[model samples]
Target: MTQSPLHILEHTFGYREFRGPQAAIIDALVTGKDALVLMPTGGGKSLCYQIPALARPGVGVVVSPLIALMQDQVDALRALGVRAGFLNSSLSPEAVRDTERALWAGELDLLYVAPERLIQDRTLELLHQCDIALFAIDEAHCVAQWGHDFRADYLRLNVLHQAFPQVPRIALTATADVRTRQEIIERLALEQAEQFIAGFDRPNIQYRITQKNNPRRQLLQFLREEHSANAGIVYCLSRRKVEDTAAWLCEQGFNALPYHAGLSPQLRQHNQSRFLRDEGIVMVATIAFGMGIDKPDVRFVAHLDLPKSIEAYYQETGRAGRDGEPATALLLYGLEDVVKLRQMLGQSEGSEEHKRQEQQRLNAMLGLCEITSCRRQTLLRYFGDNLAEPCGNCDACLHPAETWDATEAVQMALSCVYRTGQRFGANHVIDVLRGSEAEKVLQFNHHKVSTYGIGKNLSAGEWRSVFRQLMARGYLDVDPEGYGSLRLNPSCRALLRGETAVHLRKDAKLAAPEAPRRSPARDIDPVDLPLWNALRACRKRLAETQGVPPYVIFHDATLREMVARRPVTEAQLLEVTGVGDSKLARFGEEFLAVLRAEDYEGAI
Candidate 1:
């Protein structure tokens, strides 16, 4: 007897129901129709195709860019008793031949391949010999030439449609705006596919953005206060910063590692493996590090520098709290981040139109950082989703920002920039306004300017806030010549001439850091702590024996459920979420033994 999709969900994957549009998507693919799915990171997008592959008649071919993570993905599926395999550079020739044999013999329900490999003439020819169920193009946004994380190899994926016109294809991504969506549809030849745009909201993850003030110290304080013993990722803008930050964090007694394109492949793989397998390890990396990470319990994602666009920021931060538990996304940015990012963008070799689009994206990202209203509302609106009311989870909603009339302050700052030849950066211009007799101010003889010392009522930090907001609001522009000079934009003319009133978000004074609100073991009761540790130990042992990540056996969420319910028998253990038949047959006895021992010890 064949199992229905719902039956497979319950008996194999251990879920009772599908999430969002997952059921509809599976129905489409199982009926031999194509689909285009835009779901969030933790939205169970994989299930949309995986279920159809099991319910339908042939092997599902997944085109993935994460060659390094393909083995982990396959390991995870196999843990759930799904016949999954992959062909990537990580495999030996013998292993590749073995996997190919499995595919030809109809032993695999799913086969994962890199786009580069799948587009090869040899791979395409080999696929033509087998029965293909459906093609899933993961990370579908990479097909967009103007999008972040573009890959040349993805452009050739159109061949899948041309070669296998009768086979259904599903393209999926976690991030894409209207333009990129159109690009994916066109590039992949998915014009006839049904579009499923799920809501792009991660309410469990709190959003926090703050101005950079001695950012390293700020990061340390954040770690000590909120995520002291949790796993997280810290993002930097450069490889050197990644290395430096990782070293500094280790000095501060954190188990932090650096990951960048500059690291040797062996070391990078080792570091990534440890981060996935160990508890309370932090990975500090550049943008190149996290395109396809599937870790679910990341407690936080911190940015010491600004991201290039809201889309990039969304994609990176979405890695946290993927298990639907509470997570935090913290960002600390300053005017210097904006300057550095703009300089990099200006130096890019992209066409003029591409450069302009990127500049607009950067400006929008700055607007998100500087907004006094609800950050989540503004963030979702950027992606074409609207929240009916303010999301009380973001920093702005939690601590409402105060604004003040800064008309005079704006006039003083812009006039100072104009009077100082508009060639210096924010610091020098701010010095001229705040009555600083610093050496540079004296060297340039800027004291004679009429705007000099006109804004002495505000402190240096306050002036910096004004200038940062000025740049964020488009009243000031960074020079395009790669210099850090500040120039007055045409938009600032009305403000400088006192024709417009400027209301700026008042900077909050540094307060004593709050105590960690959520514990590493948030849901487990104190009495169950020992049992939780024992269960985790059991899972770790099993993972080590299998040579896979611990989460592949069971997510933290599933473990927490076990701790809460204390299932001691086969029936009770099977009732726990994520306890499918294959997992029960494989490791249920070990977990039950642990639970029974704890109960017996408690009775004593």
Candidate 2:
């Protein structure tokens, strides 16, 4: 019997199978045809190109926009004894020269390059000189106008095919709308590409939201009980919030790190690297943290703040369960998150119409967070796919949701917004519902309003449910400019007049008594012990030396990996997943310095 290339793909890439439409995409690419591969996160997206690359006759040029640098990727490949190299601005003249020499000598299998470098005059000339295989544009959605990480560099991708018209090109993205699919094809010059759209369902990831009450405590409880210190990323809306949340996690004895744009470039890079190592380090960061990151073992992605849109939420959450392991997307939200998200969008630099579209996307995210029916069904429906039941893996499934008939509650909440002229935020509305006689409440004369105290039947918590559910269901809109004041959208007219019946799912129930805390995070042994200050020092040193995302280098995974393996040498050190070439060469010495100081070596 003769061995097929797919058999070799399974052994070399550590995969035994091709998933979803992967076989078709690989077939097309191998036949010298262009392709568009759209698989969800954790789906075998890389195999679509990797398998074809190895099967093809020449070096595969994978143009990627991952947050890591050339050193990180090239090293990972080299560690596996696969001949791979990356060319980018971050590489030194000597490294770049060596890589080019290897490429020309046919010593490289895959050559990873930033899109900018791939389109350079010298680079294109070099490509012309070398025998090129397929060109894979990873993170293909960045070329799409609707994508979160839209980049002008991606727009230049068409030049690759234009310059080498015969080269097979494959564009891969985890998330894309129909419009984005078209944009990617047009932008990447893959006009004749075969398109493979995989299911967007992440059945293994549980989705849940905790009402924001003592949010700090709720977050702590969540991490402690359900999502502990596993390879998780905690999203914050601001740099300050990122810092504070990271600090809070530290206090709770979680191996947590903070990442934001405000950090030095080197610091961000190091933090990113750490997170990717994947032992388990909680990374608290803003929206800048994830874009084309390749780490596959993230256990959970939690949001302390509302994400800007459903696309962002989906992409971020998709970061979890990349290893085909079960994960969760837990959002700890309140009515306030909606307002803040709206405010940020409203004040964004884009045009009015852009803001409008952004609002629609945000509304979609809000709807998903608030939905009670099958979480899987709603998400797929949005992407023009549908599922029939709640994915058993989600919070909605573990704790079956109860419904609250809000017919009269909706009218009261809407009347409050309407009488308040829809100018006030949730705080003011809450005050009116509870009939608070506080100074601000009286100053606005909200106490005298007809709708005031009408919601007294509901507790402050219950009233919040009314409004938040209304906003999620499209009966109301949040004013983005004012940090989320309630506004009457067109859908509200019928609802406010009692012409429509409104219902919302009761919030997810707490874990049952005697049940172990819901998350694998409790398996951590820090016992909430103090490792934060130590972790920060380790994070700082790693970031300063390696010029990539600290999260990428030592993400939650690396930190936990460090704690578990305690690698003591260059030999043992390379075992960490995210420890790349630049990072190993740069910080490898200092990490040894720590191990020697603590007399720590691999034991866990």
Task: Encode model 2's per-residue lDDT on 1-604: one tens digit a residue.
Answer: 3235566454354334666788888889888999888889878787788778778888899998763655666654554346888888878899889999999888888999988888889898988988887999998888876568887889888898779999999989888877678888788877788888888988767776666777777777767876554668888889998998898788889999999999998999878777765356888999888766666667778888887777787889898877555676778887777666666776788888788777788878887777666667777887777687656655566666788887887878888888988898877888987788989889988889997777777787777777777777777777766557788889788987777787776665444322334443343575322333354367655555544334544545565666577677976766665565445665667665665454222211
Residue 475 of model 2 has an lDDT of 75
**What TM-score would every model get versus the actual structure?**
0.97, 0.82
lDDT of 2: 0.74
Which one is best on lDDT?
Answer: 1
- CA RMSD of each candidate after superposition: 1.8, 7.0
Return the lDDT, model 1, position 312. Answer: 97
Model 2 vs. true fold: TM = 0.82
Runs with alpha carbons beyond 4 Å of true place in candidate 2: 1-4, 67-69, 227-229, 480-483, 508-604
Error of 2 at 119 (Å): 1.6
lDDT of each: 0.90, 0.74
Q: List model 1 lDDT by residue over 1-604, tens digit each.
A: 4579999998899888999999999999989999999999999999999999888888999999998889889999999999999998888999999999999998999999999889889899989999998999999999999898999999999999999999999999999999999999999999999999999999988898998889999899888878889999999999999999999999999999999999999999999999888889999999888888988888899999999999999999999989999888999998789888877887889999999999999999999999989999999999899999999888898887899999988888888889999899888988888888999999999988998889889998898899889888888888868388988899988987788888999877433323343455777778888888888888888999999888999988888889888898988888888999999999999888888893533422
